[model samples]
Target chain A: MTRNETVDVLIIGSGASGAAVAWSLAETRMNILCLEQGDWTRPTDFPANGRDWEARRYGDFAISPNERARVTDYPVNDADSPMKVANFNGVGGGTIFYTAHFPRLHPSDFRVRSLDGVASDWPIDYWALEPFFAENDRMMGVSGLAGDPGVPARDPPMPPIPLGRTGAAYARAMNRLGWHWWPSDTTVATTEYDGRAACINLGHCTPGCAQGAKASTDITYWPRALRAGVKLRPRCRVREITLNEHGMAAGAIYYDADGAECFQPAEMVILAANGIGTPRLLLNSASARCPDGLANSSGLVGRNLMLHPWPQVSGYVAETVDGGRGPMTSLWSKQFYETDPARDFVRGYTLQFARGAGPVAEAVDSLAAGRLPWGEGHHRAFRALLDHRLRIGIACEDLPEAHNRVTLDPELTDSDGIPAPKIDYRIGENTRRMMAHGIARATEIMEAAGATQIGVSPTLNSPGHLLGTARMGTDPEHSVVNPWGRCHDVRNLFIVDGSIWVTSGGVNPTSTIQALALYIADRIKQRLATLFDPG
Target chain B: METSQDSGLSALEIDALRRLAGVLIPPDAALAMPGADDPDILADLLATLGRDQARVQAALGALLAAGFAAAAPAEAETLARSRMATAGPEAGTLGRVILQCYYRDPRVLRALGQDPRPPFPGGHVLEQGDWSLLDPVRARTPFWRDDRAGAA
Candidate 1:
């Protein structure tokens, strides 16, 4: 429709990574366009009631304009497509509902292949990215303790969250087990530093923080970018990245808010659309010149999909602990974070303790645990046990295998008329052994803590913290992007999200993603003169 | 009956629940709040519960019965006695089960300063530890300042 807009840089997906990059480059004076497939929802818009919140949690009655622009609901299967990745569809992307657990990857995590011979080593080391990580931490207002023995030492911008009953229990357990557990390095403000209020322990971080305590990108980076004059187009789903004659990124073709076709030209394109969408968009942008997929000369556009296998262990306590009343998870132990040759698994796993069971979710759990659906006895049992249940979750690192990849299913197409990302993944032997070990340790801890009953459940496709689709490496044959997160085939294109991760570290990926985004943004800024001069 | 014990299960509380249930039900349903003798009282409430004694005890309480029938002295007394009888550990597994369900019901949850909508907005029972983790954060500015200050 003869729609054309030009900018110095175009960022697809205003998520944790995209927003961070946009914010970092805010003062560059370069024209930047950040497109998000979700609407800009404010904290005040969240529902106060539990049922209404639950409905929104399931993405029901979400802002419809954004929904039509992007296909939010896609099926998750085990054999063909099995990744329960719940990404947010708004200006902030999944950061809106993400538990602000921003932990940096351990230094050894970068050189896993050298250290443990389990996974491939990252092209970039932790030292190279440390400055960016520190910068990102300060910018994002991370609250944590400095000099954590488990990882490198860095001063947190804010103080850590206080240890509550559960944290105390977890700490005691860790002490007894002689494991190294530390306060989570989260993005939530410990004290009133920024304009945002401090955490109130509302325990509803997943459905979006009404209290503005959880540090989502909207509250942290998006505002900074907006203030810096970075143009953010919400409800704009990028369909394809158009290339020039020289094979550089010309611009992007996207569906605007009204579902109309629009093309926005840019000197450079930084794809932070996440692992799944980033590769999907690249594959969809195939032309006669780039038939194998955009910037996919090595034929690894959507290869090496990695998801941190999540296995949960629930403990039923005797006292009315009220586990579900606070944040998602309060305490974590990285004692097993480093791989042990003594253990059967190649990679290690972290043990995180979270308060358990919202009423409805608790009911479902109870039903699963053989609680009778009805009768006086059933009701009594439910009430007596409601306050005493606690759950321990392990975000076990899954080794990257070439076989576990994200490919488009030729048979099924999403509502957006594009093939849905077909995730072919299974928990490898290393992860299964890790899960079993972690569960055994968790059961021991629970029993030691006087748990009357304990249950463990481990599944392959626990979607939240996804990584390693388009891995970064020194050689283009083995990876999609280079050590600097720049596309090996296309210099003008960059990937700063979880997609560029070479190894899925045991911790949450947000901190690492944000750090990489900052590093990449710095590189882009340094080369802005040559890249965006348009000579 | 001791008057002090009777005060806990006020006649008014029993009457309020009876009215509340009526509002929850569809207007088209002919099912009135069954009387004590109405065989369906056990069946209707226990139908969804199946053979679970806990569900039965929790659902077959003073507040639940009030919603089914018009307030009467005998009904109130019977409901109060049922509640007290199940209050003890001697009330067995069945009694404990019902007690738990009753407490979790939306009506009771609201009365206990809990928002049933967010389920447990302040956090769930297990969330106490999570709250503790946020304590360093919460101590600076509490999550429930308004509620703590007794302000709506």
Candidate 2:
């Protein structure tokens, strides 16, 4: 085993949170190094560069790590979970394939327990992270209108991307229904900013943005972090976090790209591996001092897993909506975002109106649903469904449940022979009710939009927003991390990823996750003198 | 028809695919759109068959078991619908390969009114929807719960 030189700080996983924290801590001029298991994603190598772009979604650019299964990728044992794990292992992480639909959590989202009498309230509130959110928006170059009544009034950096035909139809429907709708805040640049070119409406943003319009962390933060002297070593798969005699995280033992074992010591360690990855690492690092896990004193290192359940309603309208012509998501509705006493479910869902699928996806999906038959009048069916379809995806808020957790799969191991994460998750009753309500409401909107045919997917297997595995709270007994992302059990160890999210809000979480990383980095800088004070 | 030796597909498998592709997507004279069984599309399908040979063969087996070749055109259509148009794994794999290859064809793409090229460098322009549509929504008072002023 090779023992490398020590550093002032070490960060694991160079995805959304890792890149943000690295950039934030760069100005401190500390010897900071981030170890990423995946390499940088070359924009030219993205699927959209070829005519087989849409087909690549099911292949190389698939959201599921198990499906993509590159050498750098690790398999996730998600067969037991209804909602499958969707993540990319590259430097930009999930953002590499994210549709870039950006939405910040509402003020009420922080106080879930206080407001709805369910789940635990976050130690920090939305107001505390508001400044960081704004900062992240600016850095990520969010594009949207200012006057959204669904959340706080904050103008984005660029004008909203054009609401193409599909968005227009949904907007008109929402207006007719007297529901609140706004042009969505997306990370895709509408006008050129920060050296990246504006979107040319190539339409396939999920499979990595070859156009460089989508704001993946690699394009937004990693470059700045690298320029600021943060040494980010890619393809170094961390095996475990080692502890000194006192149980403080000394550093990590990782496997280099050549499959050689190496140990790199550091003064402090931060885990930015997302919800599942963080817990898997902790569980795999079980030692005699901390038998359960490194930060498992609370017995909650891998508990309280929250995956936002997504249900969608798709339909076909008479007019051509230009299915694959613009950003995946251009407009959204927050009508059912908050709690209503009359409703069965407590927290509600965000209605994201997105364009329909590309030709290949639509055909495959429709055929699977038995909507498009393979004979006789197939042409008529194809024409009616192809470019005329639109979708309303309901991002349902899933509260934390102890039973839904991430454990190291005893049988499944990665290429490096490290145990993979086994997810045992199921949608809760509240989320199920919320999905039903969302489907009914979305059906109404589809009808209002003059949709001739409509279809409902009660639950989509795509669990892109993984949250709350290593929840942060004031109570150490019930949480893994403290309010500022410091580990409750280990003072020198910190987590600044979705794993620290107390609750999964009913929206895409990249924006909030990045803001929390920035907030944690700021807190770390503020308490530089007393950062490791065992208090 | 020239055999696709590189694809490793048998003459029987090629014939089976040729038979199935026609019923899967019949050509439209009115729209001037070629079906999945068009000479150009079938050739492309043969070349691409190597990638998904197992799944395609499985689907073909299912079709043959259902007596798709012996049935009348209408009966064959019914058999295909019942056997291939399903949520089953074999159906999914078959549908994906057939549709992916068919849609990527320049003739099929043009018939569908899509530009027959990759979706980059020559991206399409879209009309920005009317901003005035949000006037009614903007008129409503902010509905967010202000935590600073205390819980609602």
Candidate 3:
């Protein structure tokens, strides 16, 4: 290793959780530093300007993690999983390719076991993260209406996006069905805040946002934290976290841009890597002291992986919906946000109405589904998918199962020769029942809205929310980390990403993920007396 | 290209594509849409599908043999479906890529009531439809669960 550098706190991965912690701890005036594997890409680097933009999406900016295997991206073995572990690896992490749908976990999500008699309960509750969620809303620049009856009371900072044609149709249907629907809290800005301009209604939020309107960490927290003296280093892929004589996290050994190994010694080490990356690092860090892996004394470091399965429903309409305009998702419903004894499943799902993709994407989508014809019939299908369609994404909540997990792949390795994560995930019975209910209800809503040609994709696609690999709980015997995000074994080592979630909530997990990181930073600051003290 | 200079295909394939391009994207003077065989446009398309040279060349061969350039639109389509389109997944993929390549071109986009420019640097300005479409939802009562007690 090269010269061992030291800092008060060293955070691995600068994604949503990492950025939240960085921003939270920046005020502490500690020597805080964050290392990100991916480069801090510029606005122009996004492929939105090219004429071959839609086609290039399948190659370079593909939503599939395996296809976009940049040097910074680690390969994932998703052979067994129904849905892929879809997350980007830059400073913004999934925010780079996210739809920016910011929804908080309901009060029921935190108390799943107590409420539903399935899955373990989170050590904390929705009330505990409520203030933090509000804090993140302002920080991330959420544009939405307050007074969403299903959600707890909290006001957004800006006005909501106009409920365009798609949202209007879906909302009218929800009204006719007497279901709960509201304008969604998207991270896209309607008005300017913190020097970032308003969202210009760009359609391709999935391939990265060039307008800087999306509240990705690179634009939101990284610059502010850097201004606050937090050193933000990129192109440094961390190999493993090292331990001291006391078996505390001493530092991390990482491969820098030049492929040279260097040790970053820190008074405290925080793992902000997501569900897959965090477990991959720990499993790769097998030493004599912790043969099973550091913080794997419970043998739960890479267990209980939860990837929310996405089932979608779509329909064709006569009116022009302007689907490719504004933010992708405009309206959402929490009518089934909680479970009922009537349903076979214990958990629930959220419905988000979005536009069908661009003309090229629609052509490919129709071809894949065997709906669109080639030759002379192509033009009609293209126009129908483009200007005359409405789509709803059903994000179902996945319960944590010990067998469905992220294990270290024995064969696959990244460009750095680091062992990649192997995902052995299959949808549980509960999720299947939930999806059936969700799809059936969504189809009815589509018909109610006078939409013809309604179709349902029952199988799962990318969940986009990867949680519960290194879960937090009250008991050390069954968990990797404690309630405060501290590793049960290593005092200074903290995991503050979706990896530490006890249960995966139905809605998007970014708001909760960021809130937990901020909560952990508070816990770390409060416990500074024993944060660095050895047993 | 002058004669598929950048395309990995042979001269015969280039000549075939030049003939088939007119049939694929016919010239429309009223809409100012040029045929797909326009040299600059064909070059761009060749560049777009360059990643799979073998598959594209196979499809081009099949289409040429199926009288794609000489037959009527429906007849040519039937001929393609019966002979070449059934070649395999590879042929179907090539056909789709070629069709998208034709449609996404600025010339075709302008014919389909769209701006000639790509959707970046500047995006579309869409009109927000009437909010009265939400009056039904706005009139409904709140449907939230009473509390966690009901769930528990």
Q: Which wins on lDDT, candidate 2 or candidate 3?
A: 2
Report the number of the highest-lDDT candidate: 2
DockQ of all predictions against the true structure, Cα-based: 0.12, 0.72, 0.37
Predicted candidate 1 versus true structure: per-residue lDDT over B32-89, tens digit per residue: 2122222222222233232343333444453455443454755554554454344443
**Reference-based TM-score of each model:** 0.78, 0.97, 0.92
For each predicted model, how many residue pairs clash, with residues at least 3 apart or on different chains? 60, 0, 0
What lDDT score is found at residue B33 in candidate 1? 19
**Fraction of native contacts in model 2?**
0.76
- In angstroms, the error of model 1 at B38 is 16
Model 1 misplaced regions, further than 4 Å = A48-51, A59-83, A371-376, A458-461, A530-535, B1-105, B110-152
Candidate topping TM-score = 2
Model 1: per-residue lDDT, tens digit, A1-535? 4467689889999988999999888889888989887778766666434443433432342322122223543332335534456566677776776778777787778878777776788878787788999888877788877656666668998877766666767666666665667778887776775788877766666667777777888888888889889999887778889889988889898777677888888888999888788888898889988997898988888777787878788878776664556666566777678767788877677777776655545654564455423322434455555657767888888788888877776776644556656678766888789888998988888887777668875233344465888888888888888777788877788898998898888888888899999998887778765653331
DockQ of 3: 0.37
After the best TM-score superposition of candidate 2, give how far the Cα of residue A404 lies from its true spot, in angstroms: 0.8
| Candidate with the larger TM-score of 1 and 3 | 3
Candidate 2 lDDT by residue in tens digits, A259-352: 9999999999999999999999999999999999889999998888888888878899999996888888878888999999999889998999
- Report the lDDT tens digits of candidate 3 across residue range B57-124: 88877777766767776776466556433677557566556656766777677767766555676876
